[model samples]
Target: MKRIYTIALLLASLTRVVAQEAEQTVSSKINQVAVFLQGAQITRHASVPLKAGVSILTLTGIAPAVQQQSIQVDGPASVKILSVSFRINYMEEHKKPEKIKLLDAERKRLTTLITQEKSIQEVYLEEENILKTNKSIGGTEKGVEVAELKAAMDYFRQRLLDIKQQLMQSERTIRSYQEELAKVDAQLTELRAIKGQPSGEIVVKVSTKAATTAELDVNYLVNEARWFPSYDIRAKNVKAPVGITYKANVSQQSGEDWENVTLTISSANPSEQGVRPIIKPWIVGYNNALSRRTVSGSMMTVTAGNEVHGKVMDDEGQPIPGVNVVVKGTSVGTVTDVNGNYSVPLTSDAEAVVFSFIGYNAIEKRLDKGSEINVQLAPDVTALNEVVTVGYATSGDDDSDDKSRIYGSSAQKMKREITATEVIRQTNVEFKLDEPFSIKSDGAVRATDMVEYELPAIYEYYCVPKLEEDAFLTAKIMDWDQYNFLEGEASLFFEGKYIGKSILDTRNTADTLVVSLGRDSNVLVKREKKKEYSSRQFVGSNQKVALAYEISIRNKKGLPISIVVEDQIPISNDKEITVDKLEDSHGEYDHNTGTLTWKKEIASGKTELITLKYAVRYPKGNRMLLE
Candidate 1:
């Protein structure tokens, strides 16, 4: 019985050793990545030598924020994949970035220098104290010769001066080292601000018939990575083709660097919910005791206790100013400054916070236990269209205050190795680059020029003198559908100078795409109230006011230009108030919106004028201002 028990224990111990040997750790290389508008899909490949039995392959260096459900593993058909699982490799820490490492080295060097200099200064201080304690040269009770006293005085004076000079020089050196150390610390702080987690591991259990080299492919979706579209539109004059340069701004902080890997920029986001929304029954009913609808317009005051502060950035890793950060379910809010930083006081009622911008998607984060919450907002593909209005918009002190669009290019341009080969898929478009790209895990935007086009376009000047004095140049392109252009911010350049930025508004279903080329200084426009045609009279029980305006446009350029002018008449909403149009200068009038539009062509050095007259009548006692 004892011999049998010993044999059983030995067998159990051997089985455990075999089980441990079956598990193998493998390192995978990221070969390619498909970055979408909101997320990214990483593809990694590895070659593993499988034994002729059950083997567990643990792949390392996976992104920590990977979606388990999106993970896919492909290998030889002979090897059957038994099971797959993912877990954070808490034991294995991420390697510090090279920049951070260099900065740390610099910091250490400066710190050591400062310490040595301070120690020298301390020694000098001690020596000075000793000198002061024995300052009385020779014994005071004995009278010394004048020559000896002079010699001692000279020695003491020169030595003390030398010590003071040495101490001052040492103090200066230490201050300089401290300044350098502070700079290194600032750089380290900026680099370390992007918090990255430990690498993730994927364990795959497989059964193979024989020992062989298996080429495995693994793909999964990861968060904190995205790409956005932007453009640069240039036109020399009205007769030249509109030059358009399409670009993609890619950014990632997925804790995994894509080193020399093929990139595919896609317009589809795999992170979005795939389920289609269904329409529920539309039941209409009157307001009852339990069915009363309540609307909230007033903001609740924030109680002071805790403060939430963070920075807001776009998907391209650029600071977004004027973003509204508010407490969820309350009106306590604050706007981000020019640096995209905000601080809002919070109370116990504040369970969550929301960050919203005009052209970016809103982000909501729960305040579970932290005070600092930084967020990166993706551009709302649908919200770009909201800036494309029919008439001119007024500029405000803040760019986000009005619907005014912005256009600007990157401060520096980088030359890329290759262009993209566009592939049209059923659900999304993909731009596959020809060469591999090395993108770091740091969240910095890397702009890649995708494609350029010189398309034929008709140039026209647009003006709304009542709203703005500037005449905006616009390019109208027909059959713009062939471009497959997405709505994005565009930089405008005309006559060899960069004018401004505008939205590449493609939300219109029409075949013609109108691109704003920004304001033209050569085309002068002015609107003035014609006092001779304006009058105000008070009749019995009612007041009548007649208003007239004249708009003038001058072509200062040497070439003739066709321009469109638009103005609006007030639309009365009150039943007692009535508005009548007297004259429109043969312009097309839309009664529904009280808008008048005129198309005209002016020769070089010529001016054109258009007149609009309207009248408003309201109750005599109630005052109404008309212009």
Candidate 2:
């Protein structure tokens, strides 16, 4: 019976030993990531040893914003991937098990020093009390010799001063320790908060028929990561091709530090809403009976918080970038990027949001729904005038403002559904970086290069003498649409020197794309009104003014350059006023815009002159201002 019991116990212990072991594997650090325009794809590798059975693997420390549905796994054919699962490690939410030992040690050291110094202070006070209790009196006190008393008195004074100095030094040291402690506490708080990146874990289930080592490839989607395109157009000379240094500004707040990883930036963002907007029926009516259905224009003040997300667009539904989005009566504001998309986070007291951009009229919209609130700002006539001057725009402060489209024509209104699979074909731009990159979780503008194209360009000199005497050098690039470009700030360089800046306008309707390469100091131009030939006369209650102007351009450089010198003739606004009898020497005039353009060539050290004469007639009873 005893031998049978012993055998049963041994068998039971052996059975328990078999159940104690489990199959679990740890994944390696992320080695590659594909970042899109708004999101990123993170990949991690893992090798698991299977023993002809099922096994489980967990990849820790992934981004919290990772989409579980996008997670994918790949491995050897023999290794069967059973299931892939994502979960947040809630254990970390309540407490962080790890700590910086060095910081904690230093804190303890400083605390000990403060406590010792305070204890020493109490001893000094006790010693001072003892000295006071020992002060001698006339009766029942041993009166020492005068020299001895004087010596004792001097010793007491010096000791007190020394003690006071020690206390002050200790207090100063305490303050210094406190400051350092505050900084240490801030770091500790940051560590405790676990901010700057969202951290989580990934788990994968696998099974195998035979024992083998399988390499597991895992990929997941994470948000708060993006890359945008920018360019640097540099031209060495008029004959050379414009050097376009295509750059990508990659920014991410995703939790993991992508250290020495393979990075690929795609023009794809699956987060973008691909749902086509449904247009409601528009009923246009001026009937008086419809007025009764109108709501009040006056809005009651909003005393609570409201957050809104929206796109700033034109009336034609084109995105308007760099619009200032501000909550009314608050200093908190932000400007839209090149995409013209803005997300406004409001305070509790925010009433409404105001959108303002150059060339567009200011708009104030009240937040009603939490969803997207698209606002279309109409083009202001005065603002349009400031941007479009002499057929060239330079005063537009908005980065998205099109130079050639100051008075933009309406675009076709069509709702189109765009999806992730079709995004690459739609965008037609994938910025292939030169090499591998490792970006920290910190939000920063990191640049990478794309391929450079040397397309053919024609250089021309342009001068608007009435506005400025300087002749700007422009390079007209053909087939500009071949390169997918977003309207952005361009730094222009010419002739081996950094000249200035120019805006790259892709929306301009022309056979060739024009880029201003800045001014040429060698080409001198001037416009002057001939005062001797200009006069004003009163004839039959009408005032007639005659004006003459001359413009000259000299080519001081060695190259013979063709210049387009531009000047304009004013037109009257009133029916009684007449502007006629014009004398143009060059005969290059646009009657519609009253603009005179001279496309002529001036040889080296040679000069060319253009003259214009016109008359303006207005009624004498009223005053008129003319340009």
Candidate 3:
């Protein structure tokens, strides 16, 4: 009985040892990354040397915020994946990135140097104190001569001066080190903010038929990574082709660095639910307090739209927190959250909502019922200088030929080599880069060039003198749908100079994609009121007001140009007020909006004058003002 009991204990101990050997931990490296609009898919590769039968493999170094449902593991045909799970390993610490390691070393060096300098300064201070304390030339019992006293005084003054100089020099050195340390600390704070709190581990249970080396491919979705599309539209002159450079700005804090990985920018938003929305019945009923539209009276119309909610992003597609979104001409307002998302109920008097953020240009978007208004605020150069954050870049770098510096350059003087293949998928498009790309775990954005297109476009100048005196050059591209452009912010350049920023709004249903290339100073426009036509006359109980304006355009661009001039006349909805067009207005009139458009081609050094005349007749007894 004793021998049998001992045998059972020995077998149990052997079983425990075997189980521990089968459970092994392996390190994986991220080899591929696909960044979407809202998230990213990370692919890692690991080599597992497995013995015959079942084995539990734990893959380390994954993003902490990975989506478990999206995790997938692929291995060699000989290895069968039975189960996979994820967990956080709080006890383990992943290796820091090379940049972070360097920063840590620098911090240590600076701190040591600062301590040494302070110690030297302390010694000097002590020496100075000793000299001041023992200032007498001789002891109290002994009386000194005048020559001896002069010599002692001279030595004391010179030594103290030397010590004071040494202290000042030491203080300066310490100050310099402190300043550098402050900068280093700031950088370290930013990096630590994006650093992973705990390491992530993926456990996989697999069965192997024979002893072999298996190559395991693991992929999962990470929520901390995203990318945004951007564009650069350039035109040499009115006659040149519109050069468009498509780019992707990618940012990631996924804990693991994507070093030398195959990068692909996808237009997919995996974070958004893929379910289709259901259409509800559009039932109109009597006005109630909860109704979106409510009429106060016949004269004073009160109409409201559905709640307006959308993101407010910058030109680089980064969300701007603390943005003020207020309905124009009203006190109703709301601020954007950290994600740059805001929702404000539209009031009856809401014509447009103004979005204002410091250091960015204010955007006023007209309200539309049940519409998402995603606005991209351009940086106000006058208020603040734009700062671009990247993984690494040297200040005052003289390497003009560096291809990496060419993307975000204000002028973009050099054309980068575009090496991305466009892949059209069923749901979205992708630009797969041919060369490997590396992005650190830090959240600094990296811009990659996708493709460059020199498309044929019609260039024309448009001016609305009453609203703006400058003429804006626009490029109209037909069949723009073939290019598969996502809505994004575009930087405009003309005549080899950067003009301003504009949005490539792809939501318009118009067949022609019109891109405004900023205002042109070469085309001068002016709108002046005509004195003779601006008169008031009394006819019986009614009064007639004649309003006229002259819009003039001069082509001082040294070349003949085609331009469109626009002016407007007020339209009254009341029956008592009557409006009539005077003779020879000579413009295409839109009766619904009271808008008049005139198209013309003016020669160089020539001026074209367009006259608009309109008359309004209203009852004199009922006071009305018309100008």
- Best candidate, TM-score: 1
- Candidate 2 achieves a global lDDT of 0.66
Please give the ranking of all candidate structures by lDDT, highest first, separated by commas: 1, 3, 2
lDDT string, candidate 3, 1-627, tens digits: 999999999999889658745779898888989997657889999988888777899988776667777789998888999999988777665666667778989999999999999988888889888998987668889999999998998999899989988988888999999889866765564466344356788999998778999999999887666666668899887666778998887777667779999999988777565556698656666774444665544333334323578998778786665566766654345556656788865555556888865345789987653457899998656511112221211111122343331222343223343878889887788899999999887666678888988776666788988878999888776567788787665778988999876666665436777788888888999989899878889999899989888888999988778787888887998998999989435788999998888878889999998988889999887776565
lDDT of 2 by residue, 1-627 (tens): 999999999999876545433536485778888787657889988776767666677777776656777789999999888888877664543223245456677788878888887888888888878877887734566667788878888988898888788888878988887777766654443233234223477777777777898888898877657665555788777656666665566766565678888777676655655555697656657875544466756544442223467888778775665566766644334556545677754544455788865345789887554446788888756511111111111111121233332211122212122111112344434544445678865444476665555555666788888888898887776556656554444567776777655555454335666777888889999888999989899999899989998888999999788778888888666689899847888667777888887777788899898888899998897766654
All candidates in order of TM-score, best leading: 1, 3, 2
Model 2 error, position 504 (Å): 2.6
The lDDT, on a scale of 0 to 1, for candidate 1 is 0.76
TM-score, cand. 2 = 0.59
Cα RMSD to the true fold for all candidates: 11.8, 15.4, 12.5
Look at candidate 1 and give me any clashing residue pairs. 407-501
TM-score of every candidate relative to the true structure: 0.71, 0.59, 0.70
Count clashing residue pairs in model 3. Answer: 0
lDDT for each residue of candidate 1 in 1-627, tens digit (9 for 90 to 100): 999999999999889658845779998999999998667889999999887878899998777767777788999898888888888877776777778878888998998999899999899889888888886756869988899989988988888898999999998998899778766754553345333456788999888878899999998887667766778898877767777887887877677899999999987766555566698655556854455556644444333335788999878776666565766644345556656788775644566888865335789987764789999998666521121112111211112221112111111222222488888877777889888898887655688988777776666788888879999887776566777676655778988998766656555346767787878789999999999999989888898999999999999999888888999998999999999999999999998999999988899999999999999999988866565
